[model samples]
Target: MKILANDGIDPIGKKILEDAGFIVDTVHIPQDELINRLNEYDAVTVRSATKLRQALIDACPNIKVIGRGGVGMDNIDVDYARSKGINVVNTPAASSHSVAELVFAHLLNGVRFLYDSNRKMPVEGNSNFGGLKKAYAAGVELQGKVLGVVGFGRIGRETAKIGLALGMKVIYSDLFEGPISLKLNFTAGVEVEVPVEQVELAEIFKQADFISLHVPFTDKPVIGKEEFDLLKDGVGLVNASRGGVIDELALVEALNSGKVSFAGIDVFDNEPTPRQEILTHPKISLTPHIGAATNEAQERIGEELANLLIEGLKK
Candidate 1:
């Protein structure tokens, strides 16, 4: 069987498929030529860089499976692919821990003003060291704070574990209602299990000192004007999940008005080229959508994608 990894796959995953008697090609095929060449491959894999729509699926007569290396399937028209009997799979669990880590990384940076200090201190620290210290002196501690998790999926649960370990009270809200028993593994191999209860969305807005969004992309923004209005004054917000889930304009206004004290965003509504307003804003902490960029996450994602492709195409 012939397979094409358009955006590229990990070497370990490529070897796995090759060892299983499938010919794997890691090539950069332009979108204009993708439709013409897609018919030659039985399976095609991609990360966020590639888009697989109905037109491309219709042109490809030979493709039986499509694999995504990361959690979100926004790049793929999943309903259209499945309608054509194409098996669509993504490694949801693979990047959970990595994304969870990034949430806290941004959260910590925002609360501590580390991003601002690190950038400004290098050039002017020696001359105005004490002034810089006083500027960031109002940073708060995470130990006794309330962390609100918007979505309680794998990534959300993992983030809650970190919050719990740090002694932060965690409150989560999800569409599905159920008790999730979270097992946290510490650095010294100590493990502790905690049962978390679900709460209303209003409670999360009212009670949390810090809020982290983990919702999937949808037509409407979950954190818009109304939701922002609901949040407590001077609340910290973090978004490391999919873009467009949080309303960018509303957030910017909130930041300016002091409704939102600080924000850390890893994803944006317009990727590769983000809006100038949000990117240039001094109050927000920004990253270039690198939630799943860690080495460990990439390895696990590759293995998981390979397994799914094997099951879907080989079996």
Candidate 2:
């Protein structure tokens, strides 16, 4: 079996495939260029940087699968891959803790205004504890705050647990009606599950003290200008899902106007990079979609995908 691998995949993953006599080809080229070489390999693997579009899958007839190293398949063309008899497998459970940690980090960063404080802290000078103190000076407490989770997916539910543990009321807003089927018990936590109807998206905006994005919506933006207008004062926003879920232009305006107090962003509409506007925004705590950037996660993803591809090719 021949595999064309993206450079960022786990090293152990590459070694295992290579050692198994699979001709593993690693490249750092862009997706367009990679598409040209796809015909030469039996399988193609990537994380989020490459978009496994319909055209790419159609062009490479010999390919059997496209392995995703992380949970989200937003970057892949699943329907087209299936039509082509290509197996699409991802390591969904591997990055749970890694991404969950990011949510906490971003949450704290947004509440405390860490991004702005860190930038001004002089790296070379002996400026005392000025920056440290300033960073904590504006820090807000999570206790007794209303944390509204937009989706009850793996990450969303996990995040809600943390919120509940922190003495905050956890209200989940999923599309489905009634209570969430997944049950949990917190040693020092309480989750007050609420249906999406209890509070509309607008209510989520206007009432939530802290709002975290956990669902995947790429075609249409869930929150926009009108949504922002309805936002309650001093709301902390966190987008760990696809960036398109929130209208960037609308969010930018809201941030500038102080309508949104803080933001913790991980994903973007565009992958492998971010729009210049968001990077320039100082009020946001931005990560380059490193929610699942961990050694353990990558290894598991690589092994799982490799096995799946091998088995799929045999079938």
Candidate 3:
């Protein structure tokens, strides 16, 4: 069978496919050109860069499967693929640890004032940061802080473990409105309770000292001007979740006025490179959506996606 692996795959994964009697082709094909080339392959694999829409799938009468190399399927048209009888599979576990690590990195940086410190800034007559060192350093100490996680999925669970080890109390808020009984309960100074349902937006803002977000993106912004207004000055809000989850312009305003202590963002509302103003913002600690960009993670994603495609083909 022919497999078109876009965004490429690990050398080991590519070899495995070749040894399995499948011909794998790697090309960073542009989306517009995908329909023309897709019919040549039995399966097509992709990461976020590729958009597998209805039109492209319709062009590929020979294709039987669409493999997603990562967890999020926002780029693929799942409903259309189902109608076409194309098996859709993803590498869900591939980047579990990679994303977890990025969350911890942000938590530490925010707590230790890593983002706010720069003697380099002072050299340019920007004494602002040096003067506000106290405010930045005042960020809640994670060791004893109450880490209120909004979700308890893989990345959320991993982050909770780290918070627990770091001596922070971890409680989560689940949307389904039912209690998730944990293997172990935490009632250390903070109350040990069921993850609150649709936590009063104001409550999250007012109480959380170091609020790190792990929720997925929706069409609307998660934290808007109203949410920002509820926040106690100097509350560190970190977004490792999808972009557009937080209002960027509002965040910038909060940061400038010392309402926000620090912002640790790895994703953006607009990606594959956001606009210049957001990237160069002085108050935000930014990354190029590298939440799952580790070497080991990429390999696992490629292998898992390949397995799904191969298995689907067999059926």
User: Clashes per prediction?
Assistant: 0, 0, 0
Best-matching candidate per lDDT: 1
Q: 1-315, model 1: which lDDT tens digit per residue?
A: 998999888888888898888899898798889989999999999998889998999999799999999988989999999989999999999999999999999889988998789888998899999999999999999998999999998899989999988988888999998466678787789888876667988999999999998988888988888999999999999999888888999999999999999999999999988888899787889899999999899888888888899999966
Please report, in order, the local distance difference test score of every candidate based on alpha carbons: 0.90, 0.76, 0.75
Per residue, candidate 3 scores C-alpha lDDT tens digits across 243-289 of: 88889888888888889877889888778768676777767777778
> Candidate order by lDDT, highest to lowest?
1, 2, 3
In model 2, the worst 10-residue window by lDDT is 190-199
Better of 2 and 3 by lDDT: 2
* Selected candidate, larger lDDT, 1 vs 2: 1
List of clashing residue pairs for candidate 2: none
Q: Could you tell me which 10 consecutive residues in candidate 1 have the lowest summed lDDT? A: 178-187
Model 3 clash pairs are none
- Please give the distance, in angstroms, between residue 75's alpha carbon in candidate 2 and its true position after superposition: 2.8
Question: In candidate 3, how many Å is residue 22 off?
Answer: 1.1
